[model samples]
Each structure stands twice: as structure tokens, then as C-alpha cells.
Target: MSAPRLRRVAVLVLDGAKPLDVGIPAQVFSTRGSMPYEVRVCGAAPGLVAGGDGLSYHVAHGLEALEWAESVFVPGYRHPDRDDPPPAVVDALCAAHARGARLAAISTGAFALAATGLLDGRRATTHWHYTRALAAKYPKVRVDENVLFVDEGRMLTSAGAASGIDLCLHVLRGDLGVAASNHTARRLVAAPYRSGGQAQYVPRSLPEPVGERFAATREWALHRLDGPLTVRTLARHAAVSPRTFSRRFVEDTGYTPMQWVLRARVDLARELLERSGHSVERIAAETGLGTGANLRAHFQQILGTTPSEYRRTFAKGE
Candidate 1:
């Protein structure tokens, strides 16, 4: 008997679909690899679909193609005013779900999925800009505005434009394995694996200098992350009392000194995991988080994944 066929993924491109959003899945899933996936693009009808940028896409299949898919991905379009998807499109999605096909939406494409009622009672997300509107319109759906994507067992929704790449890579990782997904990421020159729950484009608040602070102290703390440098140590570096340093640190960076240190250590640990071949123990020690056990704990709390798993999914090579 022949080996089982690869899973079939159908991308539904509607009129006014943003070309970038529609193209991400096709590019990411169609690469030559050990874990290959069959990808197809479908439209309302088998004809040229106009993109939001005025370019026309030659879609060879129509909604009929969805019947055989193992999964369906819907890309976002430009029209937010027209909250409803065409009846044919809605029917195709509902029918596919009824047969146990997984459904995914990228960016504003979530609006289309939400319209089908499949996302009802499920936690999902979209671009922060449209999150409130999506919530108001679909009160049955639990909308989280901060995440990159929400993976409900059978359905998923992603955030804004480039976030589509993040979601597609996540799905690839989950379906294939870390190595195959990393290969695809290298081919696309994109970050192979971003933890799904990472915050999407949250602006970092700049630290304001309190009473009389200097850049010297901040740099000093960075150099001593692996040691026991507390708020008192930082205040000493700045020639101030620990109490004064505490208030000033928050005013400048919007974070307490320890919070800032933890974030910095996490960032350093991530860099080491991605760029170096060092063991988890060494990485943890160098970043000042201590042993591998401590590193794994912090990684899980901050990144929603274990250290080794993060390395496997994001490391440069095998």
C-alpha cells in the first residue's frame, strides 16, 4: 500500500484580499522538505480575484475545493464595513468544519471566521486596532487583543499582517516538528518559531531620568546580571539611596529595577539560545538566571515554552 498522503491545506482568498496575507501560507507550506504539505488557493469562484492593492490573482479553484481540505486558512481583506462573508464562502467553511477540517484565520481574516460562528465561545485574537470592534460585533467570541495568536484545538486566529507569518510557522511547528519548521523558516528568512502567546507589538516605555541619574549605572547593572546586583547596588552605582533609586527607576523605565533586570536576562537568554550552541546550563549561568532548571522555569513563565523546546524550534541549525 502507498504511504499516507500529506495533509491538504486550502487558502481561501476573497475579493479585496491583501496579497501579502494571502501569500504567506502558500510560501511557508509549499517548500520542498521532509514534512511536505499540499497547499491550494481557492476563491469564491474559479477566476481572477482582485487584491486590495488592485492586482488580480489567478485562482484556479473555487469554494468546491474546500470539501477535501484537512485545514482551511482565510486571509484578511480590506473591507471591514462589510462584516459578513458571502453566503457561499460561509457555507464552505461551515461544511468543512462539520467534517472536522481545522479552520485558521490571519489578521482581519478572523472577522470572516467569526462570522461563521465556529469561533463562537472560543478564545481568538486579531490586529489590536480592530480587536475592540471584533469583540463588539461578535460578543460570543472571547477576544484577546494582546496575543500573536490563540490556538483552540480545532480553530486558530492570528494578529496583524506580519503576525500571519508567526501563526503559519506555529502551525507548521505543531503539525510537522521543530526541525522541519526551522528549515521552512530558514528558507523564508523569517523567525522560525515565535511562542504563540507572545505579545504583539506592544510599545516599550522609555525610562525617564529621576532626580539625578546617569547612564553609567544602567550599563553597570547590565554587566553584572549574573551576580547579586540588587536595587541597593544599582543605587550605589548612581550615588543615591536605594529608596530614591526605586522611585526613579520606575519613573524612567516604567518598571522596577528587578523587573527590568529579569526582562534583560530573558532577552539575553533568548539570544544565546538562538545564536549560540551552548548548553542550557551555560546559557542560564551566563545570563545570570542560575542553573538550567531556573532557566527552564523562567522561560516557561515568560515565553510559554521550555528552554530546550525553544532552542529546538528556533536554534540556527541541527
Candidate 2:
């Protein structure tokens, strides 16, 4: 009947840190009775620190915060091309990594991580504007400007500010599973999932009026996930041809209709496994996965675990 220990997270705010990047993980992993995370904001040394855009931060912890953290986030800062993070900060980050703590960076924070040499020969990225500088400065790092983020297992890096949300959600999903991550995203009003491989900058075209219309279709689909749902069915509900629906749906949500439906079903199954005591067969039927055998196959392929295993790890009151 007791809950698991909270996941401790630390936000390391370097000098000239961007406000949004610093705030993203702090708020996302906030321990204010809503999530299973405990967040601490720290600086190179606890005190006043200059931030980007004329803002300043007063952190309550210093590098010592990273000592006991399970995960440490390095938020992007200004002028990464010119200024290097304090040597002590870099050393502390290295020590944290050696202690098996997960280290993630946002935007130009990748620069600090790279300086620690942990990112050497590893794929990473930063804000598109600074990708060249990152590559030039840290030639050992395989700079990838195209991706929204890179998940090199424990070492993660994301593109500019907004993608920090994507990275945090990605980490949350890995730690607690899809159900908990989706709940957090809904609370934050952020997109539930965006694959790290997704492009950081999606090319834009002229505005289309049909964008908002598909949201209704998505909501409609969520309610009928246990029923027969297909691109044709969804397109019909949206009053569009399947071809148009498929094209526009990908543009709007970065997923084909069927792909989205399958992921949604998986998410629903995860919630059911965590919160209910139903049999796998019943859960499969309820989530429209049809049979226990079929559900296990999909669970292994998508979640890398069996339904029973997932339940054992995340089920409530176990």
C-alpha cells in the first residue's frame, strides 16, 4: 500500500541560462503532489546567477544537488559559442555521469555536456542556429541538427527550448510508462508524444483551415478505441477522403492514422494494466487488441515487455 520512492531530479542552471529551458524540467518534474518526481534547481554555486534576456535566477542548491540526483538536466544558456561553463560545473556533471545518473541537455546545454567529453563520438544536437558551432567546437561529437532530440540511452540531448518538453516527456515515458507520461503531458497542455527522431523544424506552408477539425476526430477516436477504427472510418467522421485524411493527419500529428490508432491502443492498454486488475484477455478485448496472444505480440514489439510484466512493474496496489 505504500508508493514507490520519488525520482529525484536536478536542474543545473549555468550562467546565461535560458529561462524557458531552465523552467521546463523544473515544472515538468515538479514534486507538488501531482507527479512522482522531486525537482531541485541548482546553480554552479547557490546564489545569484545571470540568465538570458535580462532575467536572473536565485537557486537554492549548488553542485551538491547533483550528487544524489537520479537524473540531471542541463538547460540551454546564451552565448554558448563564446563562453564556456565553469570548470567546476563540468567536473560535477562528469562525476554525476560516472555515478550512473541520467544526464540531459537542452539546446546550447549540449555544449557544456560536450565539454565534459561524455558526448564524444556520440550523436547529439542543439538549437539549429548553433549546430554548426557545436560541431566546430566539439569535433568529437556527432552533431545532428535535424532531430528534435537524441536519446543515447542515459545521455540525452534535445533541440531548442520547446523540445525540452519533448525530451522530458520522453524520459518520463521511459521511467514510468506511457500512461504516466500522457497524464503529465495533458496536465502541461503539451503534445503527448513526439518521437526523438522527429525533425526539429517542420517546414511550414500556408495555413490550412482543416487543422482544428482533426482534433475533434482524434477525440472521437479516443472514445471508440475499443471499437472498429480505421483511416476510412476516421476520414468519414472528419468528412474527408481517406487520402486527404492520411496526408493531413501526418502533417498535423506526425503520424499516419493507423499508426496513431495503434499507439493510442497501446497507451490505453498501459493505463488499464496499471490501474485495473483485469485479465490480459479482457484487457486486450477492452483495448481492441483482440486476444491475449495478439496483445503480447504488440506489447513486445511496441513496449519491449509482455503485458504481464508491465502489470507487475506498474500495477497499482501490487
Q: Across residues 1-318, which tens digit of lDDT does each residue of candidate 2 receive?
A: 798689999999999999999999999898866588898999999999999988999999999999979999999999999999889999999999999999999989999999999999999999878887999999999998767789998899999899899999989889989988898999999988653332313221112233565988988998998999989999999999999999999888767888788877887888888899989999999988899898888776665567777677567885
What TM-score does candidate 1 get on C-alpha atoms? 0.63
Q: Which residue runs of candidate 1 sit more than 4 Å off their true CA positions?
A: 1-4, 195-318
Q: TM-score of predicted model 2? A: 0.62
Tens-digit per-residue lDDT, 1-318, candidate 1:
876577899999988888888999988878354656788899999999988987778998999879978989999888654657898899999999999999999988999999999899999998767776899899999998767888998799988878888888889888988887788788879887565344313322123444335467877887887888788888988989999888878877768888878877877788788889999999989989999998888776666667777677678884
- Candidate 2, after superposition: displacement of residue 69 in Å? 0.7
Full-model lDDT for every candidate: 0.82, 0.86
List the candidates' TM-scores in order.
Answer: 0.63, 0.62
Q: Candidate 2: where are CA atoms >4 Å away?
A: 1-3, 195-318
Q: Count the backbone clashes (under 3 Å) in each candidate.
A: 3, 0
